[model samples]
Target: MTQLSLHSPVGELTISEEDGVIVSVDWGWSPFQEENELLLRAKKMLDDYFDGEEVEFDLPLKPHGTEFQKNVWKIMSEIPYGQILTYGEISDRLNSHARAVGLACGANPIPIIIPCHRVMGKNGKLTGFSGGEGISTKRYLLELEDTFNNLDDNLSLPF
Candidate 1:
């Protein structure tokens, strides 16, 4: 696995690529770093994304997870930037339980790129994020996307 680290507003992130497909993005720096075309491209995309530009990642991703997790990740990936979806919403679509969907979301190999932060609790309630600084990290990403402000019924951020 080849990994590269970049400093972002949220924190330092290490993106890993295997066989030219991105496999995971982890919090903190990776002690070992390697240079490759794919890693370089992923870094650039991350840079632009953190710069507040609306960028859609066009790189290949191969998140390692179960079929159910893969399906959950796929649905999360399709969530429009700055948009939100409740765990219950996704579970409804998958005919699975909300807790199961939340579990799959928590296991997502790639966080920001897969957009798992877009998933929330029912009624726009903020929930745990297995990446970065937990719920605070989720709050940061949602605020960065300005999603909290757009929530209907004036659903305030749960914090």
Candidate 2:
């Protein structure tokens, strides 16, 4: 696996690649000193995203997960940049339960790239996030995407 770390506005992110495909994007820096074309591209895309450029990541990803989890993540990847989806909505699409969908989202190896942060709770409420700073990071990501426009009027942000 090749790992490259880059600092972003949110925090330091370490992207891991295996066989030229992104495997995971973890919070914080990794000491693994390696870089490849894919890693550099991923870093540039992430940089552009953080710069509010509305960049779409077009990299190959190979996240390891169960069949169900992969299905959920695939659905997540289709979520638009500035849109949000509820667990219930995803469950309805997959014919699964909300809790199961939430679990699948939590298990996502790649967070921002796979966009698990775009998933919220019912009524547009904030939910758990596995990333650093938890829901705060999730909120930051949502704000970065300007997804608050899609949030329910009843949903309030800490800003």
Score each candidate by Cα lDDT: 0.92, 0.91
Tens digits of per-residue lDDT, candidate 2, 72-137, equal: 999999998999989999999999999999999999999899999999887787899998899899
**Which tens-of-lDDT digit does each residue in 6-54 have in candidate 1?**
9998899999999989999999999999989999999998899888777
Our tally of clashes for model 2 stands at 0
Which residue pairs collide, candidate 1? none
Candidates in order, TM-scores: namely: 0.96, 0.94
- Candidate 1 off by > 4 Å: 154-156
What shift in Å separates residue 32 of candidate 2 from its native position after superposition? 1.1
**Candidate 1 CA-lDDT value:** 0.92
